[model samples]
Target: MRHRAGIVTDEMLTIPKWRFAVIGMLEALGVVTGMYSAAMLPGPAIPILNQTFLLWQLGFSALLLGRRYSWNKIAGCLFVAAGVVTAIASGSESGQMLSGVGLLWPIMMVVSSAFQAGATIIKESVFIDAVAHLKGKLLDIFVVNSFGSAFQAFFVLLFLPVLSNLKGIPFHELPSYIKSGAGCFFNVGASSGCDGSPLLPLLYIVNNIAFNISILNLVKISSAVVSSLAVVLSVPTTIYILSLPLPFLPEGVTLSSYFLFGSVILVLGLILYNVPQHNNIKHNSDSDFM
Candidate 1:
């Protein structure tokens, strides 16, 4: 069907191979390092570190794309950082406060996120200044995502031995681990057995897919920094959900005053990030082409 629609033609398949290769390699590294960092860090710390990527993205975008930011945008970025820091500082689990292992973990996550943001910005730049017949056609986010994901899977598989060893799994057990994972994925092995309701995994899978799609769409319509800001704005929503009496959560989960204040500040930051001046600038640029 894709072939009939010219979507899978030989012409479409032929692109500047080096561009795709570079993007794919960065994406692969990002995925591997992100997984490693997530394994090493605490859950709450992960979001805080992930949110820091907004700064990296903004800086790199300006440097690489010569993107200009309004003063409001800069203020918004600062507010986001302050809000995240406030929430983290006031939490009960904030004892480490970037000391010892805590410092290392967040740094690793930030590096990983920088790779991801770099890939995002490069892809967006390609779309903004496309060449030849590939101008609009190659800008498809789905195509970019499919290629990036394929490359990520290949790299992950290539590094399986290293990753397994890092996790303290024996080399000989790697095959069994792969087999068990495949079996569990297919729901045909002992590993498939779940202690809780089956609906949980299904819901998780659904949510994961939806979340990925939403993020990719955001990156397509806007810049990487905006996409990161959108994710940052969701921190409060995640906190609220965790505070609820969920089935898997322990009882007595509650939000602190600092967290609430930080959430409010984060929302304001989001609003500032989308100030009318930004839209006006974008509108004027589009009108130039028209």
Candidate 2:
């Protein structure tokens, strides 16, 4: 149907091959490292670390894309980081801080955010840079996504041996481990650890794919910073959901008493970031008059 509809454009085809390869490689590193580090970090730490990507995104967009922001946007990013940290810290148990073997993982997570942010900025640049050559036509999201995914798969294959060994699995034993995982995913294996089985995993995969596509589309339509902001908005929602009583999950936990206070600060930061400043409005009015 896509072929019949001609969604693939000549403009998309004109994008440089190296661009896609770069995006794929960077994003692959980010995903692999991020997942590994996340597996090691405490649950409460995940949201806090994940939100740090907004800082990385802002930095990369400024450096790579040569974009400037108002002070409000910058403060908004900091508020977001502070809010998530405050909220997560409220529920954290004593001795839950990253230390010992866990210390390196937190650093890796931050570095992973750098990689992801760099890739996202590059992706945005692909759209921005293409506008001139394509005569204002934007590149197709699928074209970027498909090539990036293919390259990411290649990199993931290359990283598998090292990744497995780092996780304490022998390289030779990795195949069996993956096979056992597949079996468990299908619910046909003898392993009793497969609780939700194929259904839950499949649903998770579907939802994740949709979420990623939406993020990419958002990046294409707006700036990389905006897309990162959208992702940041989800942190509070995730924390709230985690506190809810839900089936197929452990007993729900409550948010820390500080959650409301942090949330208010977060909301204020968001409002400040999004609402146009008086100077900006005056400038826009002057431009219109001229």
The most accurate candidate by lDDT is 2
In every candidate, how many clashes are there?
Answer: 0, 0
Q: Which stretches of candidate 2 lie over 4 Å from their true place?
A: 93-96, 99-102, 278-290
Candidate 1, 108-203: lDDT as tens digits = 788988888888777767656543556555455556666666776777677878878889999899888888765565566445254344466678
**lDDT against the true structure, each candidate:** 0.71, 0.78
Query: Model 1 TM-score?
Result: 0.82
Q: Residue 93 of model 1: what lDDT?
A: 57
What is the per-residue lDDT of model 2 for residues 215-275, given as tens digits with 9 covering 90 to 100? 8888888777777777777777777897788778668976767887777777777776776
Task: Using TM-score, give the best candidate's number.
Answer: 2
TM-score of each: 0.82, 0.90
Worst 10 residues of 1 by lDDT: 281-290
RMSD to the true structure for each prediction, in A, is 3.9, 3.7
